[model samples]
Target: MRPLVLLDVDGVLNPIGRRPPGYRRYRCVVEGVTYVVSLDPRHGRRLLGLAEATGAELVWATTWEEHANDWIAPRIGLPSLPVVAVNADTLPVSGHGEMFKTPAVAAYAGLRPFVWFDDQVWAEDEEYLRVHQGVGDFLLVHVDPAHGLTSDHLGMAKEWLTLTGFSQGS
Candidate 1:
């Protein structure tokens, strides 16, 4: 079975700083709040290549939504992939509510295993993963702000793909 790889934008693909040798942090004002960002472009390309080589379906799992297709995909050399938009219907009662993209992702993935790359998975994610353990497999991958996709993260993805009997020829 093919696995889906959910890509996050902010901290994963686009960092708050420059790439590689000149990795530095910078502040950016988005919407109204200022955010500290830093992502490596090289790592983003590597991830795109890995996705292509592994036959994993890419899905946008960022708050940027469709904008990720326009702004982020180009830098990474990936065309438009599917997107899991945030559900605004569920209102948050406290300090920042959960935007569970899992439902949308699950719908898109069907019975396929999926890997979620985001900086925002919380208690809801844990609960969801617990309940749907057998229906569809989910892997939560956390990317560091300073270092893009680490060896460990890529290794995990590689292992999953191999274990599931997925080929690199999608």
Candidate 2:
């Protein structure tokens, strides 16, 4: 079984900042609010290349949810991808201080190995995975919100894919 690649939008693809060099600004309306997100044009190609190299399924794990396919995907040249449904009643709800997406991502991953790319992932989330999900089968990559996903991060994902034995096609 191919490992799942869970992708977050806010910090993973669309970085948070005053628009760094090479990043383009895009306005998207979600829930009646207009949000301006910074997206690096290269990210799409890199992510797609990663998927091709690892033969992993790229799944959306962002708050944008289905809107990711509608808005962000085309902007970055990605085809439609499976989205992990996250709701208020889900295990990752607020007030727990744990990342609202941690449990949801884990649950979505099920027994399949997964690699989660998010900006908000912290040590506590890692601890939760260590205790509840064990270690080797999963990877939680915490991206810097200011820098977004860099070449180093992609390198890490590729390395994880290789280390986890997910690398087969490329």
Candidate 3:
């Protein structure tokens, strides 16, 4: 497998901040709901670099879904990427600890090694991935919604991918 880098748009890319330094704000209207987003263009380059260094394919895993491809990708200078089929508006799972999107993420990843960047990852989500029988080496990079993605998060992913032997799929 080529491995995967899963990107989340809302909290991971668009921080909780209304407007932050070094980030450009954009207005995106999808189906009549206008959303304002703060994005740093450098993040695109950094994410692409990570994927290249590790021989991974970047995929979107966000509630924004396909809209991410239209609005978020171009702003960050990233090409269109595959999106995990998960709905953020989906109701919570009966399991208290598991995230609603966890099952879809698991299904999409299958046996591939995946690095997921999201602000909502909890211990239970990590455990869910870890205990799965067929999942490959995975890294859950917890991005703070307030600050968005940082170089430190990318470093953690690189280190994990390298240590796990998933780097370059070698």
Candidate 4:
């Protein structure tokens, strides 16, 4: 099976503060409710291209969920892909609130090898990795707002694929 790449919309693909003035905030009406948002379009395009180049399946691991597809995907030059929506009403784990994405990602991809790109991962993520070490290939990648996806992050992803013996074309 092809490996999965769980993408976080807000901070990973879309930088928080890098877009233009008005474009910075996206307003939308979902099921009769209106909302506003902001995102970085340039980096989001790069991330989409990367997904196409790597032959990895993309799944949304974002809080925006259906809203991401309706509002964010088109802005970033990406068409709709599978999305994993978190339970919005639930309270996050006390200290590791960021790690909430982990369970959604794990459920969405099943046992497929996956690389998670998000600004939000915590000590609980490390613990999840340790506990699930024997289940399937999984890599947690932290993308910084300042640098986007750095060489180190890409290298680590490439290394994971290489170590798993997955061949790439050029």
Q: Candidates' TM-scores?
A: 0.71, 0.90, 0.93, 0.73
Q: Give lDDT tens digits, candidate 1, residues 47-115.
A: 776677788877887776786676666655678878876544652222333345655555566677777
Candidate 4 lDDT tens digits, 56-154: 777788887877778878876678878876755673443543376665665566667788877877668757655653436778888885445444776
In candidate 1, the residue pairs with backbone N, CA or C atoms under 3 Å apart (3 or more residues apart, or in different chains) clash, namely 15-38, 15-39, 16-37, 16-38, 17-38
Ranking by TM-score: 3, 2, 4, 1
Ranking by lDDT: 3, 2, 4, 1
Q: Which ten residues in a row have the lowest lDDT in candidate 2?
A: 88-97
| Candidate number with the higher TM-score (2 or 4) | 2
Score candidate 2 by TM-score against the native.
0.90
Q: lDDT per prediction?
A: 0.65, 0.82, 0.87, 0.66
Off by more than 4 A, model 2: 88-97, 133-136
Candidate with top lDDT is: 3
Residue range 41-142, candidate 2, lDDT tens digits: 778899999999888899999888899998899888899999988654654453445677777776788777778899998888777666665334788899
RMSD in angstroms, candidate 3?
1.6
